[model samples]
Target chain A: MQISQQQRQLIQLFRHPDEVEFSNIDWEALILTGRQNGFLARLYYQLERHQRLEDLPQYAFKHLHSAKVFADAQRQQAIFEANEINNSLSAIEISPVFLKGTAYTLLDHPVAYGRIFNDIDVLVPKPLIEKTEKQMLLYTWFPEPIDEYDQHYYRQWVHEIPPLKHASRRTIADVHHNILPPISGRAPNIDLFTQYKIKTEYQCYVLSPAALTLHSLVHLFFEEDFSKGFRDLSDLHILFSTHYQDEKYWQQLRFLAYETGFTLELFLACHYCEAILQTAIPFTFKHELVAFSPSPMQLKCLNWIFLRVLQPSHPNYESTSYRLARLLAMLRGHIKKMPIRILLYHTGHKLIKAFERGILGRYSDTSSNLQPQPPDKNN
Target chain B: MQLHQLKFDDYIHKMTNDGLCLDLGVGVFRFKSHITSVQQNVYEMYADYNITEDKPADFHACVKLAKGPRHYINPQVHFESDVVTPFLPLPKSQAFPLLEWGMNWCLSAYDFNHFILHAGVIANQQNEAFVFPAPPGSGKSTLTAFLAYSGWRLLSDELAIVTPDSLTISPFVRPVCLKNNSIKLVKDWFPQVKFTDTATDTTKGDVAHFKPPANSVKQINTPAQIKAIIFPRYMPNVPVTVFKLDIIEASEAIASNSFNHNVLGEEGFKTLVKLVENVPCVELQYSDVNEVATFLQNEEW
Candidate 1:
């Protein structure tokens, strides 16, 4: 697809952050709407990465946008500190996965130091979630009770509970019990996080640099949960290029994968990061991993996998399509483990709904007006 | 109650006998003196007039009023320490009684960051809360009104606070606002139901308020755990049939209906999933209040 005018200007700004020469389009308008929104970042970094970052406009160098960057970084520091305080009091022992900005802060990057973080992501053991919640309560972080049944459900089932938000602090802490589904589902061996765990400087976080990379890829491909856009991709590029610099790191990563039961996931991440970011994964390592990941359907499956993960904002799409796509992606993720019959039942139901919405337009938002008013109900 | 006594900073006012306490943010308005006048407007609109006292206005924009020991109280408006106060003139005595029911007028003045959802909730005799989650036209308020009148305890006829782990409902049991024709349908079914006045040309068609069922008065402070989640899609002529929804589907629905899910992240996702697994979820299709009530009562909850 041809890039929109704003997209083209965004591409220019991102590639040449040092050059601020726009003819008619205001520089503030260019960066504020296009770049700040993460749209342009998504297009260039996630969708198209062959584009060079050196070509983007340079607003920071002019000292005008420098304050914005500084403020963002300071905001990140505040979040990190607040999260650290929560961690000190939390009951569950959580390992921080140094995601984008947090990771950048950890690695001492020369770029903007204090970026604003929306949340603090931490991985926790599944069994310890209840205890963690009790710990959260000690700090006055409580979930609003929607219903008793909902409370029972979250406490008993599910991967993680809704984030415990500090109402006054406005800090959101995501507590994950499992990295992957414990049931027959895609992304197995989530607990393997224990193997490659390492502590960070600020807190006692178990981080596997390689697992972190794979997790980022899982988030990118399967989760398509791309709210950060260019910034996240940039982090991926930096981490990949900087961490996996030696043959020792590559062999260690491969060994780490074999132990963790994520040989395919690690290999795919390495291959794609290199292909997309022009990241310098060693040729010998790339060739061997490619031989192991020989499936044409990997990319096709990856598309829906990521699409489901990213779950776009296309309100025009049918709810059934959204649900079916999610189910299919999930089933495929756990193909070998989960029962085919159960998957079939779930997938069939979703597919039928998708078909109904697609062909008959039975559930169009456009007909939301056709919704029966109170006593007018005549379904 | 007058408007001046409601101010949080001015607590030196004389208390009045037979006055209702008003808690509006930081300002307290002891408003029993004006209750009769306020009730005049409220009765014209078919809504009850009452006083809320000693309520901590957790939100910054609230205005409280109540009757003090010896004198009438005024409207009290509180502002957060750091933020500049917005201009909110206390409505005159005639406008006083209609404030709470008419607070929707102040909706535009608030920030647009949050999406406003219109729905209601009620708890069974067991105190298990059932969230009737729906968009504006789903007849949630109408159904909530019927249920409240049918002896079920009304929890809230508005916002259902869906938190990270549980769906907590506020015990704001005032009156259920029945819009447009639902008012007539309700009146025809329950001829004994006391309605305020039917105000016309309002947003939700012709609107009126139903006296909260007596049980609601007692349960106004009780918060119920969400036991059943019912998505009501009222088809004007359709027979009442409830379709049981599966956990996965219900989880998705709860997530979408949630006030602040995305901000909650993995915890939110897990909460919704957990809720679906435990709650008996269903999609109810009905036209008549009688069938809807019967179906709800008969469900194997």
Candidate 2:
């Protein structure tokens, strides 16, 4: 992607906060863009590392410092929630593998520094999925009260169960049996992932280095939404950079991607990271990964679409092409997830619900409730 | 420059495009909207605040009227920032309320430099401010409107941003929100005070905002030292009474009323402790605003 000068500056500051000077930067746009990409706190933490506290601009320093404080509190809360889940599921004889954000925090990876996460995703053995759900129910975790259609979709087609929320704490957990949906025809063997799980200091399991990178790749590239594209791509950059120093890491990543039927995901991750983030990769590996790329015409279209979609969705950077590209990406995601018939049924149902809510004015009354409450059916 | 200084057409054009950046004492906000009523409200309510032409803003917000599916059936207004929409849409007529609510949301949600309290603040001529840390319907707004129009300077009627290290309260001189019966009461008590058209059936029940005194807006950037913290409640026909609260009680009350105390963590705790330790805390219960106002004006702290 040919990022703008502002984006380039942001990337440089993100990578080497200690080296970049911030005297002449546009603080407003930088803060807005960082916030849009979920990197405001991360940016603040980086700047804090390199600059003296007294030298910073008052407005910039105060906001960033405040963000850092908030990030710390959220991180602590996430850890506490993870520990609670761990203690709850201890009786099931199945250790939950913390995935993505929670795993990053639990393992204390650099990526977790100043990261903000909403939900905890955990994976379990396919055979133990049923037992784990029952155990969670005993511990007061229930499947979020989604409607019948969504419940059916999750149970019959998706890789994970309907997201489970604790009754009191309201922390969400998604229990997954595979990385990709079974209906998507790309679901990898559960054993391939289970074999690489490693114990962490906190008594939970996280994916091994190679598996972690591959999973992040699958999560980022295979997902339909680009709302968190920049943040997720940053995660890939951090993981690759942290692990790439080991000579064996590259080979292991390639071998694992091939074994898990996710070589395309890994290739795209490497391709974009190298192009956008300037992540270093061995020349031979870059050339070798090209063999796993899609056909030339499809590759060209995808590259054009993804480059637009991956950029921060700030208005200052957005264009009509980007909006169209996002739509194309969403369509492509649905196509990749299910066969045409099921896709049509699902899309039709959602469209009708939207039409009813919008056109028919089914739920037009506005309530005066002031306190924040969990979203209910009426909302 | 101020918002009213611009021609109505120019103000609408700027607001619809980039946004009209207004300095709200503690912070700057860029507000964008295409709705004519919203524009008029801003012009009337923010006529005294500073308008930034090319300067950088601390926050950007917009009240976008709902389009497509829901527009024709029942129009709605959405409160959005550059990053996310914090709340669901409301009726289109409530755009002004949505703008105020959105601005408050931005300050409370994003501005972390200050320990924010859901309180009303009014200052004396010496710049010693009294903070009323209370919840909704606690007569805080009534007392604030009464004091502001009577003699005291209205710093802010909704938000009080106290610096964590210094415990100095920064001024956010905006309109005082008066709800339901208080709207009539304030109008009756202070006939000279200007108010925007009352919004009926609002979430806060027939809400109207009374303009701050001109002197208060002129000294918007001035900081004030905390003189006392009072938790006020209104009970009809109850004898007007004031009870002193200890440091622990005051700290707990202030913390509970704070918006970002938990997010501030240890710094939040320390700031609250310092505020409680140095200031006298009291709870005043009364029915009449004048009775509470007289007591507050005469009380020696």
Candidate 3:
């Protein structure tokens, strides 16, 4: 990815916290970019570790401090909710596997430090998906209402059911039956990931190091939206820098990637993590990674889109090319995700919904700026 | 110089493009609005706040007239504060009030370092502050407005900012939002006071804003030592009876009304317990604003 000037400074700051020349930095742009991209708190922790938190301009200092406070609270809530989910599922003898942001947090991995946790994702054995969801519903979890089509769509064709939100706590939990949507035709066999589960001290199940790395790599690569792409890529960078030094871990990641039919995700992860973040790779693995690179033309198209879409989506640094790139990414993802007929039905349904909302909105007397209506009538 | 000192033309010119930045005592915010009502109201209400191009703007607040091309069909304005917007778009008429509410959200949501209470605060000349922590329809703003005009320095009419682990409070004096029947009552009481044209049928019912006095803005950086927690109940035609609240009751009241006490968690509980014990807590019930003012003034410090 071609990082923006603001993004480069953020990466540079993350790499070397002690070298910040505050006067040269645009405090506003950096904070805005960091906030939009969800890493302000991580940078705060980095500065504190290097004894440079105190050196920040008061403006930057407070913004980072505020982020740290917020992240710390979320971490506590994440732990609490994870415990609750674990205890609830334990009743049915089902061990749900936590994934992504929540899993990294439960493992106490450095990558989880200062990460924002909005929801908890858990993978259940396909046989126990219904049983697990039932247990969750018994204890404060209810479906965030969706239309009949969406409900059918998730149960029939997708990896996960509709997300369950806690009644009082408002925490969302996604129950996945497989890593990828089963309809995608590219989903790996569930056994490839399920066999490598590691239970944390919290009695929660998580993927092993190599397995978790592959899961994250595949998740990022298969996504349609890249609003949080830069942050996800950074996650891969940290995952590699921490684990790739061991030849065994690197070999295991490649083996699983190939076995799971996600060699492309593995190749892209390594390429961007090293190329973008300068995540160091051992001298031995460098030449072998080059062998997995896509053809020059394909790589060119991928790079052009990824580079534009990965930067912070803030107005200050957002380029004119981002919107077009995002549209291309979304289109590429849809084509990759569903078969032809289902894709047409889904796309057509969404267009009709948008048009219906607009027509209904037009009937309301909203032309007059002075008259008051319900706050959300227009949106 | 305070914002009023800027030439009217330059002020509008600045707000239309680069935004007008001002210090609101607790933090500085850069406010931008293209809506005519928002500009007109802000020009009248926020005249006393200091204008600056400070290195770090604590919040970037704006009321934009555009939602998209379809915005021309509906003509709505949305309040955006920094990166997060907790509010939905309102009719363009509500833009000024929407921005004011947005500013409050920014302070309480982003600035978690301080304990922000959902209350009003006004202090005596000795800088001994009286905090009025109450719910909506409690006549809190009307009381705060009456006293702020009657020589008491206004610290804040909403979101009372307290320094953690201390009784010290900072001034966040902006325009006091007076809602519904209280708007007419306040206008009648202070005939000369300038107020925004009341926006009707808002979520809070008809509402108008009262500009705070210039003297309060002068002490924007000054801190106050909180001496009392007063919970006012506007009972009609009643005597100004001051009832004492025990420490536990006071602490519970303060805790429930606090915006960030839960966010701060354990430290917030400890600081609040200490504050309730330290301050004299009382409930003042009265119908007449003048009587309530006299009762407060004559209280033992």
Candidate 4:
């Protein structure tokens, strides 16, 4: 909800790269923090846009420039993967709805221009999810060899199936039936998103602007991982700046969120996008978003946690209270996504694993050669 | 000021407290380590290196001695490159060795500005760089340490920070890491060279790092133009053999040893072509350092 002084330096430069006052900045911390928050290359783009790259110290300039080169390569690879997946799934009469990073790349969204993607995320209709996975496996994409209990957990409750990784290429693709897990009881009807699909230039399907923005918002607010919080919020700012129109546009986005049972997500996204990123949301929408807000006490607590978590730091460097915030936020995420009984079961199972790894000196699977190989046991 | 100017106690206090900020030729690093082995290694190996006091560093790395219930039973030291541990904590005995490995990891992973080649580099008195590009067990580091003590200046033991288009490499004159039998053989051969205690049963067998010659560290800021690429392999009891490689053959061999040329793609290919065209490549196989050193001396650049 608020930027730290460190975040302010980064956000300020993002807003006005050409005008950045060099004297006040700690170039080392600034560079590392920018990189940690997934903004280094994006910041390169900003600085490049303003023709201010020449002003940076050579070391800073090289790192930022190098990040752009890397991000560009990753984006190209993602595009190639999306088209390959599109070609594969087309045989089964399913055009997967690419989401998040893949969708952003397919659409050539500037916000994602300099970002990295861990995997390609796509959604298919619930009925086709099985067929889609079978097709993927037939085409040399196998479910990642996760543990048996984890496999059961994903199958029983998670939004997506186990990730399907390409055999030779080792690239990952997340095939999802719903954006939100069905156990959330608030997973939107898939058809609502499907209606707005626009075929990309490469023939991969992506949601139209409004629906896409709504989904991004939902993903941002619901996910516990705040490591990419700044990147996601920055993306929303870019999307809003491009998509913002008169009252009708805001109204349509709100209606979609309401119809899809994500009014709360929409509210949080709008409030934070404006508050943190300084996005120019219409005053009318701001007033209307208030209706979706939690109580003042809840808001205060949310701000306390989100502010610290949003200013991302690597886990090792995190202060004890910040780690506590992350833990609370993670538990809060579990509660938000699962029913009470399922949440308890899932939490207990994970707690035991954590205990074994931490207190019981299992340490890691370092000495073990028991990793699941081909002909995965999960299937 | 050079690091050797500080008293040993003062250096350890500074390294553990305010951190030892080293301008390591290729990149500046702030090393904050409480581990005695790590501190001692820095003191011994980095005596002639410049210290950038109170300056912002390029990387903030640490070798922290692990603390927990497991600590007393099985002590380990984490090799954290900046905010994250690049590798799992190693046995506390391996602290100094881990730091050496961590420094290389930091350069390869974070210093995207240059072509960080997986090669050992040594420059003759004229500052003409000779690159020995080889994978592990190829005796690259061993050969590099052997040459550095035998009058050549060591540029780098693990990574060669090649500046693209400049056709030059900045000296990365840290300690040369020796593995397994080579550690003992090297220590015996070069009796005067200071070496860290052998870190037993490391991933690279028994590993130890010996200091670069002081002359190399003294010229840490000097950049050397590469003159020859010698792909070396240690063949026990083999006769000294030197085979000249044509440009294409040399290009392919050096390319395999380059870490980030793949990252650079076509541009890197062009640079590799230009380098091979300018610098002759050769393959050397020998067990005797004396024979290999004499061969290198007699060869035309």
Ranked candidates, highest TM-score first: 3, 2, 4, 1
Question: Candidate 2's residue-wise lDDT over A90-198, tens digit each?
Answer: 7767788888888888888877887888888888877888999999999888985667778799889999998888898777888998888999898889788778888
Residue-level lDDT of model 1, residues B1-301, one tens digit each, is 3223244223223122323343322122232222333434323321222345433221222223322221233333221111212323232332232344334322212211222223477888877788887777888888888888888888767655443455555455655677787889899878987766665654345666776665575555567777788999889788998888887787677666665444434555666776787788899999887887777777778
Instruction: List the candidate 1 regions with Cα displacement exceeding 4 Å.
Output: A1-87, A90-117, A146-157, A184-191, A224-234, A244-248, A297-379, B1-301
Q: Is candidate 2 or candidate 3 better by lDDT?
A: 3
For candidate 1, the TM-score of chain A alone versus the native chain A is: 0.63
Candidate 1 lDDT by residue in tens digits, A1-379: 2223544455444444345354444443343333344333232332123433334344312222222333343445544644564465443444444443454455454222324455555565666666766777677666654444445444544456766666676566666666554444554466565566655665545455666666655554443234443344444555577665666667767766676566776666665555434567777787778655837886666644433333222222225655566656555554543357755755675576556554533323232222222211111
Among residues 3 or more apart in sequence or in different chains, the pairs in candidate 2 whose N, CA or C atoms overlap within 3 Å are none
Chain B of candidate 4 achieves a TM-score of 0.94
Docking class of 3: acceptable
User: Candidate 1 at residue B141, lDDT?
Assistant: 83
lDDT winner: 3
Which prediction has more favorable TM-score, 2 or 3?
Answer: 3
C-alpha lDDT of all candidate models, in order: 0.51, 0.81, 0.82, 0.80
**All DockQ scores:** 0.01, 0.38, 0.38, 0.24
Predicted chain B of candidate 1, TM-score versus the true chain B: 0.66
lDDT of 4 at A174: 95
Residue B77 deviation, candidate 4, in Å?
Answer: 1.8
Candidates' chain A TM-scores: 0.63, 0.90, 0.92, 0.90
True contacts kept of 4: 0.15
Greater-DockQ candidate between 3 and 4: 3
